[model samples]
Target chain A: MRPLPPTQRPNWRYIAAEMVPRWCPASARDMHYAILGCEASLFGDSNAASMRTSVISCDGGVVIVRCIRGTEDDVETALATVTDVGVAPVALHPFVTSGTIHGLKKKIVIRSLPSDEGNYKIGDNTYRILRMSGQKVDLVQQGIKQTTALYLNTDDLEDF
Target chain B: MRQFPADTNYSFLPQGRFVMKTADACIYPYPVGDASLRRLADELELRGFTGAIAVGIPAGCTVGNVRFLSGVDITANSVKSCRDALRSAPKTDVVMVHAGDAVFNRAILGNIPLHILRGIYHTDKRAFDHVSARMAADRGVAVDIDLSRIISESGSRRQRTLERYREISRLSRKYGFMLTISSGGRSLVGLRSVRAFVLLGAVAGLDELQVCEALAAPAALMSPHLSVEVIE
Candidate 1:
C-alpha cells in the first residue's frame, strides 16, 4: 500500500508523563495496554478507536503517549485514570505536551541520581533510600515486599 | 474581576489585582501516611500548587512557595452532633463536612459555617439534591470533588463515583454552587499535577476554567474576609 499523503495522515500529539514511584518495573508494553484499557473504559471502544492512543516510549520512568491532535486532553484524562499497570500500583503524571516526538523528548529532563542506594532511619524504623530526585526521596522499609514505598523529602529526614 | 484584601499570602500582579492561587484542598500527611508536612508542601510546589489544606494541621505555615491551611473534616451521625463538633473545633483555615442523608445535608448547608461539603460519592444518591445544592450556593459553601476515588477505584464503584460527580457538576452549573477539586492524597504518589486535575475535570464534563476555579476555591475560602477574584 502506498503511504498516505501528509494532508491525509492524522495529526499526532505526544504527551510526556512521569511514572510515580519511578523505580516500578512497568514495561512499555504494560503501559501501552494500561493506557489503552483506561481509554477504552473511559471513552468506550468507539471513541478510544478514534483517539488512536499509543505508548511510543517508556524510558527511565518517563513515558511518551501518542494520540491524535485534538484528543490529547482525552488521552490525558485516561492517563490520570490509570492507577496501576497489572498488579503494580502507579500513576502516570503528565507534565508536557508537544507535536513531535523530538519536541516531547527535548522537554523531558532525565536526572541521573546516585546509583548507590543509601540508608536512613525514622523513629527507630530503618529505610533504604530507593531513589533521590531533587528534594523528593523515595524510601523502602528495611524488610517488606518492597511494594510499599515511602515518599519523603530531605527536610523530613532532619530529625532522624 | 472581584476584589480581595491585600495580604502577603496573595501575590499582587502588576495590574493591582490578586492572582488566583491554585491549591489542592485536601491532603493527609504524617500520621496518616509516610509523607511529612514539609514533604507534602514541597510536592505541592512542584505540582504547581501555591497552597494546600492539610487535614488536621494548623494554618499559617509556609514551606518554599506553598502555604498550608488547616482543615477539619466533620463526620457526624446527626445535625445536632455535627453542630457540636463544629463548635468544639478550633478556628481553622477550611471546614469540611462529610455528606450525610438528604435532611442532614440541607440542615448543614444552611446552619453551619462550613467551607466545603465533601465525600458526596460515598453517601446515598439523594443526599445532595437540588435543594441542598441551592442552599450550598446561597450559603457560599463549595462541594468537594475528590478525584482520589476516581483514580483508585474501578468497576461499579468507580462508575458510580463518576456518575455522582457528573450530576454534581451539572448541579453546580445550574445552581451556581462552587466546586472544589481535591486530590485527597495521602502521600506524594497520590498527588496529581494541575493539568491532570483539569483533564480529570473534563472527564466529569467540566471545562478547564471550571477546574482551575475549583483548584483556587480553597484559597478563597480560607480568606473569608476577602472577596475572591477568579481569573479568566
Candidate 2:
C-alpha cells in the first residue's frame, strides 16, 4: 500500500535552498536552472553530502546527475566509488597495471603508456594502476579496450 | 531517433556549483488576482523564467499566463476560475483549453472559449450537473477524447500516455489548434530536478525542441518575471 501523501509538498530542493540561509554559510543561490542541493548549507568539504547524487545520464563526454534520497551518513558507501562524483569525474575506460586490493580498493598501475585525453571518455569503464595499498599490481598488463568491446558510438544526436 | 547514451544510466556529478530553476514549480490557485501569483511572477522574473500557459479558456491573457498543465490537478473553485482564465487568454497565449471532467454539467465546463471535450474532472461520477451542461453543449465541433476518469486523472504513464497524446495531437491538427499534453503526474518528479524525465521524453518520441520547451517554456510563459537565458 502507498503511504499517505503530504498536504503541501513545495519542491524539496526549493524548500531546502530557501531555508538554507537560516542555517548556512553560502548565500549565493544556484538560481539559473534553479537546481539546489541541500549541501548548500555545508559547503567546502564536497565529499560531505554534496559529493553523492544519483546518476541521471552519462555518455563519454556529457553527463547529467540528479538529487538522491538518503540519510545523513550512508550517502558515500551507498553509492559508487567516492571518486565517482562531479561532472566527468574520471574517464570510464578501463586500463590495467595492478596495485593491491584491500577488499574493494582493487588497483593496478603502470609506469608509462600512450597519453591521450580525447581517447578516454567518462563512461568508458576502464581503470589502470601500479601500486595499490602497499602492494604492487601485476601484469604484462594489457589495456582494457584491447580485450573488450564496451565502447559506444554516440555522435549523431544531441540530448545534452 | 536519439537513444539512451551508454553511460546514461549512471554517473553522478561531483559537487560542483550547479544551476537550477530560480524557484519551485508551483500550480497556484490562479485567476483570483492573489498576491502569491504576483509574487510568483516577480520571483520567476528575478530568476529568469521565459514561458508559461494559462489553462481553461485562455482569452484575454498574454503568453505565459497559465499554470497547472492540465491533468496536473484542479479544485472545484479553481476550475471555475480556470474557465474564466481560458476565455480571456490571448490567442498565442491560449495554447490549449480544457473541458473539465466529462461527467459534470454546464456550470463546471462553463462557456470555455476554445476546444470542447468529454474531459474528466474530479473522481466523482454522476456528479455536478452544471459542469455537465457546460461540456455537453458543442457537439461535432472538435473530437475530444472522453477518457475513463480512472486513467485520465493523472495521465503520466508513458505507454498509456503516448496514445492519448496521439489522439490529442490528431485532434489539434484537425481543429487547427495546437496540442498540449496535460501532465498526468502519476509520479510527478520536479521537472527541474530530474534528468530522467528529459531522457524519457527523448525516448518517447519527443523531439529536442519539445523536451527543452517542456523544461522551461511552461514556467516562462506562465510567469513573466522569471528571467531566461539561452545556451548555445
CAPRI-style docking class of model 2 based on DockQ: incorrect
DockQ of each: 0.43, 0.02
**Top TM-score: which candidate number?**
1
C-alpha lDDT of candidate 1 relative to the true structure: 0.80
Which segments of model 2 are wrong by more than 4 Å?
A1-160, B1-26, B29-39, B42-48, B53-111, B115-158, B170-175, B181-205, B208-232
Best model per lDDT: 1
lDDT of 1 at B217: 89
DockQ of 1: 0.43
TM-score of 2: 0.27
Model 1, position B30: C-alpha lDDT score: 77
Candidate models: Cα lDDT each? 0.80, 0.27
